[model samples]
Target chain A: MDKEKYAKLEQKISPKPPLLKNVIKAFLVGGTICLIAQFIALFYMTFFNFTERTASNPTVATMIFISMLLTGFGVYKKIGQVGGAGGAVPITGFGNAVVSAAIEHKSEGFVLGVGSNIFKLAGSVIVFGVFSAFLVALVKTILVKMGVVSW
Target chain B: MFSIYITSFIVGGLICVIGQLLFDVAKLTPAHTLCILVVTGSVLDGLGLYEPLIDFAGTGATIPITSFGNALTHGALAEAEKHGLIGVLTGMFEVTSSGISAAILFGFIASFIFKPKGSV
Candidate 1:
C-alpha cells in the first residue's frame, strides 16, 4: 500500500483514548495523592514540634517511602496505568520510578543491576534539579553583588 | 483549614492535568517533562516567583517535583547566605539529602525482596 493509504489504515485500526475521562481520572488521583501528603504534614505540625514548613520535609520523605513500598508490591504500576500523569506528578511518582527500575533489574545482581540501574529513570531528575539550582544561585549571587536586584 | 485543602486539591489537580496534556498533545517524554519542570521550578524559585504560589496553594505547590527543586534552591540560597562560597558546594544535596537517601534506601530494600517478572 502507498504511504498515505497505510497511514489511514493504521489510524482506523488504532483505538482512540478517552481523553476527557483520562483527564478526570488523573485529576482525582493526583489530588488524592497531594491530599494524603498534606494530611501527613498537618499531622506532624499538630503532634510534633514541627511548624508547617518544617513538617513538609518529613511529609515528603514519608510519601516517598510509602510509594516505594507500593511499587515493590506492584500496586503502584496499576495506579500508574489508571492515573497516567496523576501517578507521575508527585514525589511518589519519583519513588515509583526508582523502585520499579531497581525491581525490574534485580536479577542482574545487586551492585551493577540494582545499584547502577536504579537511577536510570530518576537520575536525570536529580542531575537537572541540582544543576538548575546551582545555575540560579550563581546568577542570584552575581546579581546581588552587582546591586541589580537585592533579596 | 478547609480552604487549604480545597486550594491544594484544585492546584495539585490542575498541575497534573497540565502534565497529562503535555504528555498527550506535546508528545514530550516523561523524563523530558520532569527535567523541564524541575528547571523551571528552580528558576522561578530563584526569581522569587514560586514562593508566592507555594504560599497560595500550600501542599498543592509543595507536592510536585517542581517544589523539590524549589526546596533545593531555597536551601542552597540560605546556606550561601551563611557560609558564602562553600555553601554552593554543599547546599543543594544537603537540603535534599533526606529525600534522596530515603528513595535510595527504600528502593534497595524493595529490590532485594522482590524479583523481576521475567528477564528482558
Candidate 2:
C-alpha cells in the first residue's frame, strides 16, 4: 500500500484520545497537589519564622520528601497514571524522577548503577535550569548597569 | 487570604492543563515538556513577570516545576545585583540548594531501603 493510503487506514482505525477528560483530570490532580502544598506553606508560615515569601523553600522540600515516600512505596505511579502531567508537572514529580531512576538501576551496585543513573531523568533539569538561570541573571545584570530596569 | 487559595488552585491547574495539551496535541515527551516549561519560566522571570504571578497566586505559582527556574534565576539576579559578575555564579543555587540537597539525601536512603515493584 502507498504511504497516504496506509496513513488514512491507520487514522480510521485508531482509538480517539479523550483529550477533554484528560485535561480535566490533569487540572484536578495538579490543582489538588498545589492546594496541599499551599497548606504546607501556610503551616511553615504560621509555626515558624517563615513569611509568605520565605515559606516556599520549606514547602518545596517538604513536598519532595513526601513524593520520595510515595515513589518508594510505588503509590506515585498510580497518581501519575491518573493525573498524567498533573502528577508529573510539580516539584513532587522531580522527586519521583530521582527516586524512580535510583530504584530502576539498583541492581548494578550503588556506584555504577544507582549513582550514575540516579539523575538520568532529572539531570537535564538541573543542568538546563542552572544554565538558563545564569543567562537570565547575565541579562538582568547588564540591564541594571544600563539603567534599563531595576534588579 | 481566601482568594489566594482559589487563585493558586486555578492558576496551578491551568499550568498543568497546558502541559496536558502539550502532551496530547504537541506530542512532546515528559522530559521535553518539563524542559520547555522550565525555560519558559526563566524567560518570564527574566522579563520580570513571574514574581507578580507569585504575588497573585501564592503557592499556585510556586508549586509547579516552572518555579524551579524562577527561584534559580531570582537567586542569581539577586546576587548579581549586589556583587556584580561573580555573584551570578555564587547565587545560582542559593534558594534551591535546600531542595536539591534534600532530594540527594533522601535518594540515598530510598535506595538502601526501597525495592522497585512490578511495573505500574
Candidate 3:
C-alpha cells in the first residue's frame, strides 16, 4: 500500500490561517486579551495548586467574570467597538453574549428574558462546538479504523 | 518565560487580525466568523496540528474562542481512543465544560447586579 506525501498530508491536515496585517487594532486588542489571560493562568499556578493544564479552566472563569462586570458597566461594548473581533473572539466574548442578551431582553420579563436569551448569542457557539467535535471525531475514528492513524 | 509572552501575544494577535479581515473583506458577521474559526480549530486539532501551535504559543493558542473547538475535539479524540466510539459523544464536553459553565453562572449573577444601560 502506498502512502501520501508528508507535505501534501500537511496541507490536507491544516488549513493555513491568514497572517496578513489587516487591522492593527484587532491585533492589539486580541493579543492583549490573551496576554492578560496568560498572566491569570500564571497566577493560578503560582498561588494555587493548579498545573498548566488545570489552570486554563480557572483562568477562563476569571476572564469571563471580568467580562461580565465590564459588560454590566457598559465598558465591554466600548472595547468591542474599538477591537471588533478582538473584543468578541476571546472567552470574554462568551461573557459578552450572555450579559448583552440578558440586558437587551430584560423588558420581556425574567423567565422569557434573562433565562431564555442569556444563551442567545452563545448558543450557536456551543452548538457549533459540539457539532464540530462530533464531525471531527467521526473522521478521526474512521481514519484510525482504516489504520492510517492512531487515536 | 519572556518568550512565552511574546509568542502568545503575536499568535493571538494574528488570529484576531484574521478575524478582522473576515469582517472587513469577507463581510461575514462576527457570529459567522467565529463559527468558521471554531470549525477550523477543530479540524486542525483533529489533524494533530493544533497541539504544536498550543505548545509553542501557550495561552495564545488556548485563549482564543477557537480553542474551545480544539479542546472539545481533543477531548473527544482522547475518549474515543480510550473507551471506543461511545467515548466520542461523551468526551466532547469534558474539557470545555468550565468555560461555558462559568460564562453562564457569572452572566446570570452579574445581570442582577447591573441593569443594562441603554445606548445613550
TM-score of 2: 0.95
The reply for model 1, stretches above 4 Å from the true place, is: A1-13, B117-120
**Which candidate has the top score in lDDT?**
2
Separately for all candidates shown, the number of backbone clashes (residues 3 or more apart, or on different chains) is 0, 0, 0
Decoy 3 TM-score against native: 0.90
- C-alpha RMSD of candidate 1: 2.4
Candidate 2 residue-wise lDDT, A1-151, digit = tens: 9999999999899986689999999999999999899999989999999999999988988998899899999999999999888998888888999988887888999999899998899888888888998998898898889998987
- Those runs of model 2 whose alpha carbons end farther than 4 Å from true positions after fitting are none
Report the first chain's TM-score for all candidates: 0.89, 0.92, 0.83
Grade the docking of candidate 3.
medium
Candidate achieving higher lDDT, 1 or 2: 2
Q: Which ten residues in a row have the lowest lDDT in candidate 2 chain A?
A: A122-131
Query: lDDT per residue, candidate 1, A1-151, as tens digits?
Result: 9999999999899876677887898899888898888888889998999986777778888999999878877788888888888898888998988899988888888998899999999999989999999988878876876889876
lDDT of 3 by residue, A1-151 (tens): 2355776887688755343434788899999999999999889999999997788889889999999989999999999988888888888987898888887777787789888999898888888988998999988998898999986
Identify the superior model by DockQ, candidate 1 or candidate 2.
Answer: 2
TM-score computed on alpha carbons, candidate 1: 0.91
fnat, candidate 3? 0.77
Per-residue lDDT of candidate 2, residues B1-120 (tens digit): 878899999999999999889888898999988888887788788889999999999888898889989888988988898899799899988888877887777777789989999975
Q: What DockQ results for candidate 2?
A: 0.80
